[model samples]
Target: MSEWLSVCVAISLLLSLVTATAAYMLYSGLIAHINVLTGSPPIKKITFAYKFRQGLYRNCGQLFRESHNIGPKLPCIGVFYDDPNEVPGPQCRYVVGSILSEGEKDADKELQKRYEASGFQVFSFPEVTHVVTCWFPNRTFFSSLLGVRRVYPRLARYIKERRLCAHPFLEIYREGRIHFMGPLARQGDFYVPEVRRAERRLSEEDELHSDSDVSGVDSNSEYSSGSGVLLSDSRETSPADSWVHSPPQQDGGDRGSRRRSSGEVSFKELDWEQSGGQQQQQQQEGTEVEPRPEPSQKSPEAPTQEWWGVSGEE
Candidate 1:
């Protein structure tokens, strides 16, 4: 019985020693792997703040690429470290990847505050750490004036409130500008304008519209006319020269009759009519406009033809 007990004790001790050795080997292997992935050419500890900044930059770049629907162009994510003291550490310390539209971009605001709160010397330029990629589509308006016809009034108001010179999106991709921001962190080199020309136009148009609205006067109204001799003079003048652009004179009788309808025409409609008249005049001068090729075959016209809210063209 004593001999059997001694053999059992020896077996238990040997098993315990083997287990300890195996655990140590696994721990060492993990540490080495992490170091190799993140450690710079010369292995060293990068500052915590720097690492965080790099992480954020990587996050922003990934988001930008994803938004454009062009991923896989970049390999390792590049981050702009906020800490000047923190040198570049491991090349792979940052994760160059993004989750599929499952997170908020503003998630990093708290991170921004954390760094500012810590007070570290980041870099020479103002680090615009907030990550946003704005896009503006082109606008087409039938009558885009500073009056009731203006579309997107809220957007115009917002631009005024911000006092931005232009829409931030326009600055990045202006009409005819090439897109070149790419190549990992090199995309950071592109400076997107905070405001754009469109925003400025909006501000100006809004102010004009508001003033017109408040005075109960449309911009095209006679009351809104400036003190220009051409506008104020009532004397019948000769047809304007070819070089000069002017509203077409309504032919004598029927046109004179239409003058009573000062209240019915909208400001925008009138403006369009006046501008379009110039081209019409240019096309018709010295030659009678052969009546519009009467739509192939004349069909029955609507019994109640609504021409400018009136019965018919006399």
Candidate 2:
């Protein structure tokens, strides 16, 4: 009985240990997930500018007004990687950025110098269109992961809103110079005014050519109508030629008689032609033209038929 009780207690202890281990693992995973989602900034010694900028964004409307005209409010993302308590002040890093646009190399270098002078380690990417608030840090896998989650969403949103076609987002660390991590959301060349102008010119030229072709067609049609010779010789004959070729008439009466004779001859010819055509049509159809019945006439009465007799009563 004692051996059985000892065995049961040992089994219970083993079960409790397993449960505790599982719970600890689950709790750690939950915390890690929360950290990833929230993108909590790492502990780092940041400058007053970094803190002020963050506070400004948090209370943007209440603390700052549009009257300040600091340009449009851009999407900003924080980047930090070292624990200030562990790293020395000069070695710690903190970074943030809001504006992103094409930057000149010389200008970027100048900006970097200016920021470094203010005790900030700025990452200036000429290829990348971004304004970052950066500082030094102790590199770690977890810090890098946190930075990606924190910055990627903001960078993607900025690219989409601005319709940026091509931009670089990458970071490298070598020779004590720290390059921060960034994301390129799209792939293509940036827009240029020259390309747009060239397209517009080509379209305009095409339109002009089309207009010219249409105008040529219209002009050719007009020219043909105006300069074309009469196809029929009969159309070319004038009224004067007919009058001159005709025999001379002594007076208007002779002219009128000639015209009447010609007209009568034409009328007789037309009547003969019409009759022949009607006979041919009837033969073709195998039908005879039935004669119309004449109206009946009353017979003449004899002179003696009108004899009348006086009434006997009269």
**Candidate with the greatest lDDT versus the true structure:** 2
| Model 2 CA lDDT for position 243 | 10
The models' CA-based lDDT, in order, is 0.23, 0.27
Give per-model TM-scores: 0.17, 0.18
| Candidate 1 Cα errors over 4 Å, as ranges | 1-11, 27-48, 51-104, 119-314
Model 1 steric clash pairs: 38-90, 39-90, 166-195, 166-196, 167-196
Residue-level lDDT for 130 in candidate 1 = 27
Best by TM-score: 2
Superposition-based RMSD of candidate 2 using all C-alpha atoms, in angstroms? 45.3
lDDT of 2 by residue, 176-238 (tens): 222333222211111122222332453354345444563323211110100110001111112
